[model samples]
Every structure is written in structure tokens, then in C-alpha cells.
Target: MKTDTRPILSALPEILKDRCGAFICCASYEERSRCISGAVKDLPFERVVIFAIADIFSGIEDRALEIKSNFSNKTNSEIVLTKTHEPLFTANVVAKSLRRIMDDGINDIFIDITTFTHELLLILLRQINRFKDRLAKVTCLYTSARSYSIGDPDDRKWLSKGCKEIRSVVGFPGLLVPGRPTCLIVLVGFEHERATRTIVEMDPELLLIGKGIPSVEHLTDESHKAPMEFFHNLVQTMVSSRGSVEPFEFSCREPYQTARTILELVTKKPDFNHIIAPLNTKISTVAVALAAMANQKIQVCYAEPETYNFNGYSEPGDKVSIFDLDWDREL
Candidate 1:
């Protein structure tokens, strides 16, 4: 990708300001409102497609509509997505639609990935990889949350109320042979127990923790990662009984570097089936997806929450992270 990373909107790069074509994003309840609005204000995107997710949770359904209403005027077209059917099916549906648009001369694509679920994003990448050769100048837009409204370290709750299940994301079913043990790699996020639950459910032989490196740009001020720090300590105890727990650092700001780091980490454990849980920033999620897509032996997984903390999820940060797609990678 390019090294021209603009820190904020004020120092807008000529590319984002001049040529943001076909903007696509979810009409999400939380940070999406901030991302879409922010992009519209700073960038001159030619057309926009907003997906209003028809979520099973009533809490998200109503709130997601509010964003749809606000952006409906600015949006070129609005589509609703239903995930109750299946993630594999849903991802292909979106990917095929995007491919069609690409066929119709919409080339310079920009995706605001602020609110897409990890299940949707990872699977969609696998589907899109089928036509990666046709992709050109596809970029991802992500807004950082200033902080999450996490409860006390001793409290029973954190970002989400409960975990519904820890299942393998459909599109990325990595290689699981008969004799090879599994290695579960997690890019840890703000959630206190989802990663813990994911580890317990998978019960893999190796656990790798991908923690975001500290940053001075409002990110290090992200509540000093009190919740996740406490979480890592808890997980260390769990891994002590099983396989070894290895901790690695990744950049929350730069996705390509994070992707390289993940590939390198998984490459060392050649004897195990690699399963990645992307629970960190959207940029890092992009990294995890890229690494897995480039290597089919590497699988990506997600911990689906039973219900999100609607009242106190997060407030959007001022900065945004952008990553250009490297479609030339053989998938």
C-alpha cells in the first residue's frame, strides 16, 4: 500500500478529498453514524450505498433505522441485509453485488467498515477474493472509538452482556486435519470475556494474543485498556493448563503491518491449524482477513455476542484509519 497516511481529516490527502468513488457501508447504530457523516463531510465520494442490517436483535433493528433515515438523503441506494439466514450466503450476496457494480464501471471503491460485524467482513473477503483481480483502488475506512464504556474490572459485565456461541465463521473454514493440533490466534479487543469464552470453546493447543501496541494519539488514552489488561491476565491462567500462551504486538493504526505480523506468527506454528479471532479494531480485522484470505490454511473465527451493550458501547474518536486493498495477492 501507500505510506501517505493522513492523521486526520484536516490534513486531508488529495485522494480522499478528490476521488472517493462508490462509498459502501452499513447503516449501523453505533460508530457508523460518525464514520459515514465524517466521510461525507471531508471526502467527495461520487456514490454511496448504505446497508441497513436487518438484525435479529430488536435493540439493533430500531437504532440502525435511525442512521438509515439520516443518511437516506445522502445515499444513492439503500439495501437491507438479513444475517439470520446464514453468514456464508449473506457474504456472497454482498460480494456478488459489489462485483456486478465493478463490472458496470464503478472502479474506485471505498468501504466504511466502521460497523460491519466481523463475521460479515471476514466471509465477505473470502467471497470477494474470487474476483480480486478486478478490484482496483478499493479502500477501507475505519473510525476509532475514543473509548468503550466498560464496567469495573470486578463487575460481571463488559462490552456485551453474554456470549451466544463461539463458532467458526463459515467462509473461512481453515484446514483441520486428523492429527494436527489447532492454534487459536486472537486479536484481543475491549471485551472482557468473549475472548476467554472463545478460547474455552475452541480449547486449542496453542493460544496467541495479538494486543494493540500503545499509541500516544488518543488511543493510549483509551482508558489505558483496563478491561483488556485484566482480561489478558485471566486468559494467561487458562492457557497455563493447556498449550503455551504467546503474546504479540500489532499496530491498531496500520493494517498492513499487522497483517504481516499475523502471517509471520502463524508461519512459525507450521504443525497446527491456525484459527484467528479478530476481536480488535476494524483495521486489525482487515489485517486478519487479508492474512487468512491469502492463506486458506489459516481460518478466521468470531465470538458472537448474545446482546450488545447498547447504552454504553463507545463514542467515536476524531481520527480515521484507511487501508488500500492488495488484490494482487493470490488467494
Candidate 2:
């Protein structure tokens, strides 16, 4: 199947008119998650699973229950509150559900990727990719935000507050080198603190800062320009001693392009042990997963948050992008 990406308004029901046999999504405090879930509420769903992650400080139980009530669980649906940070546990829940769906002979699925944590989203996508052989259609739906962290931008009050741990994703631990300087490539987002915190923790010898390009077709420019510049300024302050801190641009909306962009960076710095830490949008993390999976030499890392600013993370945008993704597509 061909990979088709479509960015549309939720008001246009005619676009996602096709029925979905199963739905998978994470319950999050962000308004965009609610908007995306509501937008797909009318779609026919025999099974639905809303993963409510119970990490130490993030609070989202109420919202998960609210979202569960709106969807059609004609056959069965569940709100599983998994009590662990292990990415494989999340993978197992999704894998078990996929196995059941395949047992029932359903080959199509819809995944709402609006508010999954970067780490969680990567795990889910990898799991979905594993079952691509049995599945016919994998449609990923995401709602772009109108704005992020409505409060003071520098404070980043609405995003995560502090970094809990900086580590490689469970399955995506890239290769190690006996004698090589480490180069950390970060996909910067609204949370400037987290990116800076990652540098403080990893102490990578070199740095490649990834600032988003607003040129993406799905996401309009300028709304993100000011903050992106802010992100660049803070992340560059790390001052890598081995090589000068470099800056790179990638589409904030497109995944494959960003994957290639990261790959190009990896090519230029072959002497260094490459580590990709994504503190960016869910969409860009999609790129991180694609890039890391494509190149085992590229390890993907995350700065797990100590706490999130659940008060005001983001408000939902009117536009929603739906991708009929072929998980098995070569990168």
C-alpha cells in the first residue's frame, strides 16, 4: 500500500468517512488529544484501548476516562493504566491487542498520535511496524496545536518542568564505540529546559541542535518561529568542546524528511558515537523513530520528565493531519 499523508480540518467529516475496526490512542492532558479523540468518535470501532500511563508525576486519569466514554466500544474497549516506565510493557499491551484483532481477522487499524509521549509513540509505532505483515491499513491521525505553553515562553510553564532521567529508549539503544567522542543530536521543541537538561546529564562531547523548519506543508510557519529561535539559543549554550555546536533544520510536520535530515547529520560526523535525543513534537519523534530504526548506529534517547505542566500544555488546532501510513515502508 502507498503511504498517503493528508492534513485536513476536523470540521470536514467527509475526509475520515471510512470506518475503523480498531483504535489505539494514549490518554493525555493536552486538549489536542481530546480534540482528536472526539473527531474520531463517530468512526465505527469494535475495540478501543486508551493507554493511561501512570508515571510518577504526570496526572491524566480523569481525562482518560472521559475520552473512553465518547468512543464506540461495541465489542470491547478498555482504559489500561499501566504502572511502569518500561517501554516494552506498553509494547506488550499493544501487541496483545493487535494479536486479538488479527485473530478476529481484522487487518486495519486507526491510531491517534496527538498526545503520546515521544517515547511511548516510538514504542507503539515500532510495535505496529512489527505487525505490518498481517495488517492491511495503518492510519495515524494527529492534531496540530494552535499554540503551546500559553504562559511565559521562557518558563515553559505548560510543558514538562524537569528531567527525571536521560537514557536511551529501551529498544533503541544505539551502538557503542570503544574510542569515540559522543555527538548528541537533539530535536528541539517548546520545552527548552528539557533540551538543556539533557546536555547537563549526558555531557556529550559534540552537539547537533535540530530546530524545526516551518516550511512543512501541514504546519504553517511564523507561529513557531519566535520560540524555535528561543530553543536554538538555549540549547547552543551547552558549548561542546570537541567540535562547535552545530544547528540543523527539519520539517516540524513531516517524519520521513526529518529522518533523512538526521541521517545526513550522522554521515557528516562518523567519528563520533551518535545519540539522538528528541525533545520535540510527536511528529518529529516519528522522524526520530524512523531514523534510529533505519540506522542502528543511531541511538534514540529521551529526557524523561519529572513533572508535566498539565495546567496548560496546548490548545487544539482546527486542522488535523491523517496519514495512511505503510509501516513497512523502507526509510
Query: What's each prediction's TM-score?
Result: 0.85, 0.90
- Residue 23, candidate 2: alpha-carbon lDDT: 84
Total residue pair clashes for candidate 1: 0
For candidate 1, the TM-score is 0.85
Candidate 2 local lDDT, 183-208, one digit each (tens): 98988877777888887677788888
15 Cα displacement, candidate 2 (Å): 1.8
Q: In model 1, what is the error at residue 326, expressed in angstroms?
A: 2.0
**Residue 14, candidate 1: alpha-carbon lDDT:** 49
lDDT of 1: 0.68
- Model 2 weakest 10-residue run by lDDT: 1-10
Q: Report the alpha-carbon TM-score of model 2 versus the true structure.
A: 0.90
In angstroms, how far off is 137's CA in candidate 1?
Answer: 0.3
